[model samples]
Target chain A: MQERLYSAPGCTSEERFGEASAAGETLGERMRRSLEQDIARGDLAPGARLDEKEIAERFGVSRTPVREAFRLLAANGLVELRGRQGAIVREIGVNQLLEMFQVMAELEGLCARLAARRITPAQRAMMSDIHARLEAMGEENDPARFYQINLEFHEVIYEASRNDFLAEQTRSLRNRVGAYRLRVTYLPERVRHTLKEHAEVMEAIFAHDAERAHAAMRAHLTLLGDDLIDFIAQFGKE
Target chain B: MQERLYSAPGCTSEERFGEASAAGETLGERMRRSLEQDIARGDLAPGARLDEKEIAERFGVSRTPVREAFRLLAANGLVELRGRQGAIVREIGVNQLLEMFQVMAELEGLCARLAARRITPAQRAMMSDIHARLEAMGEENDPARFYQINLEFHEVIYEASRNDFLAEQTRSLRNRVGAYRLRVTYLPERVRHTLKEHAEVMEAIFAHDAERAHAAMRAHLTLLGDDLIDFIAQFGKE
Candidate 1:
């Protein structure tokens, strides 16, 4: 069996990543998170079968809850249900990944544009604070920490948009794509380019220029030209 | 109680509104469509309680499927499951509606932009055909027909974007908002304005002007300033 899934992926950091968070979260949900983390970390490869009896015994649970957990996983697109073959980790096609990336770029751009127009003083300070931390990284490339912090930087903009529904949708999309991206290591040169682009987005938002913020953020994240070609190559290996 | 829900809301017109469609659709799914249509038409008003036994009797089904259907409704945001009290139709807040509208506009704009860049001759012809139908309506105002055709016009662009995932998401958003918009009647004046706006979108797409197509489509559909004000007033009435 796979794992249970959250309908709303993440409204906050605690809901998203905390191992033992969200009061009243069911046992199935916790197990689901453990399995989800395993999948994201590539411990469970794509197309790998999640045997019901095996997983149930491994997790020290009965088949009933395990079956329910597999249903949840299927709902989350983490697993595909085959008639008699139980559940298998979904193999995401490159076309679908590309489509997701394109949508994510536009949604991020909208968040940036909204943040430029609607950010509060505290939100502005938070953005600047994150910006400074990223800039402080200099030439040192740490993919793990960079990935974590990059998410924080984006989350700030999503929160600043002042639209919970919009933010929730964006976060759900982010969670869906996160597994694929987790497999890719950030290169030193790519990190350098990303730092420069972050500055461009930050400057636009600081000046309260919505159009510029939208354009700048789109440029920063859009996988086009060489970036897209590089992603396809990396994706094939994953 | 309530109705079952489709996870992927309307990947096509047939899946969205057809009574006899989608081969092998479950009995619960069929009942769901009837109830969903009832809700959309205001026959089942917002905040209405859906009694499990009563609904089961009405649909000539057992309590088991009724409960399963209610769960599906809750998942789709069509109903709220309140502990042991059973399910009630969900009440959407004004702020949430506005947020959804804003997101929908941007998604449609992205479709238009991509359509301009990637549209084939066949897609271009289809867009022209829909545009002609819309223009032919002229001052002969029919809100129901206009709304139906307007969706077709937008769907054409969505298809032309050549991204199935993006198109599917856009369609899902359209379905979510359809219930709310179903209550509003387009005045003759609004129809004239729609015609003018559609012409602008059509012209931009015909010329392969991606930026203009994006901006024009946003302008066409965005609920901003006066349009938003009017919508809020109308929404309150609904």
Candidate 2:
């Protein structure tokens, strides 16, 4: 069943980009999105100074939009705007990274707790469907596909909480830690463990057991943080 | 004891203002601080439109600095920037308010948990002193003094966590909800209940019991949210 779903041509990254363009996003918004993707993908390293002139020239645009993008990025905690040094990709220190994961665990746990109580039947069904897809991706040992599906799975819980402010904050925090977290997805056995953990969270939510769902989500995130710290301890060697 | 401390005129609001002026803060930073105080004190009501020209003239500064102040306010989630209408004090809906409290509870709980494990002796002594002051304020039936002391009590825990990012984020969230929360602090019996709750949290932290501290802080904040909701439902009367 999972294989069939994976075989189908679903919404690819390119399609998402196309949709954004079709929606008539501003130049600054588009530049911000592109720059964010580059940073998250490690194409731009932490502490890399972003020159407005260089970025504008590279993108064949003026510096105004690039500067605007920097402001947007800085607002989201993605970049730091220095007085004369311009904008640099902000680095998360080890302590900060651990602290972020601690907060992320609580936020996600809160989402699961709320979702268990407030999720509509349709939303629960949607989560189950995504969970199934995630399991399939795990079985196929495709970390890349699993990572994307895993994000959608968590996003559904955020929406199910029916709290726009909470959802936005969670999404922003997730993005701030995304670059560091993305590497952890490639670790062996991680996908399998993640699949099991998602199952527990899904089952608890389906049963409307808020406490169980919260605990499951918190434990999952805590373990992920432990794994991430271990991976970093290995000097990020594959 | 708390009466003696309160009578000392320690760091009164006027003195704080004098200190800021003495520090020679930037015009934009000063403007941002002034606007934040207005909003937090309800001097500037929710959804009130802020005009750049008016603010600049009132502060005897240029429109350039006023615009910068607006950006800072927007970044802190205290104001909304509407292109043509300028900046407006953001009105947080009831649901969003509840959600913010939920997240705030978790963040503070995490701080307490970390503080239990990491707090230095000096930090612990400071928290104990603040907690004692809070109890005295409660006995004197001085909610106003209790309110100020209560903030310092939590600040001690945030600092004890030794996580700069987490501390900063927690402080920002607390400020975001401070305006709504201030009214609830005035409710009859609230100060007494809050004093007891602080004692439990302080005792747990002092004992180095991480789980107990976490639970105590969470329960305290959850009750605070419940009281706020009930207080608001009465239309904030009496």
TM-scores of the models, in the given order? Answer: 0.82, 0.86
**CA shift of B181, model 1, Å:** 1.3
- The fraction of reference interface contacts (C-alpha pairs within 8 A across chains A and B) present in each candidate is 0.41, 0.55
- Candidate 2, residue B168: Cα displacement in angstroms equals 1.5
lDDT of 1 by residue, A1-238 (tens): 4433422233332233445556655555556666676666556777778887887777677775566556556555677876556788888787777887888788889999998999999998998899788878766666667877878898999999888878988887777767667544276667778778888888898899999999998887773324655866865754
Worst 10 residues of 1 chain A by lDDT: A6-15
Model 1 residue A61 lDDT score: 71
Question: B1-238, model 2: which lDDT tens digit per residue?
Answer: 0111112233433233335463535566667777787777666777778888876765667887677678778877899876555788888877788889988998999899999999999998899888877776555766556667889999999999997777988998998888788778767678778878888998999899999999999999999999978977888532
Kindly report the TM-score of the first chain in candidate 2. 0.87
A1-238: candidate 2 lDDT, tens digit per residue: 0011122234432233335563544566678787887677666778788888877876777886687678778877899876656888887777788888888998999899999999998998899899888776656766557678889999999999887777888988988898888778667678778888999998999899999999999999999999988987888632
Q: lDDT (0-100) at residue A157 of candidate 2?
A: 97
Candidate 1 B-chain TM-score: 0.82
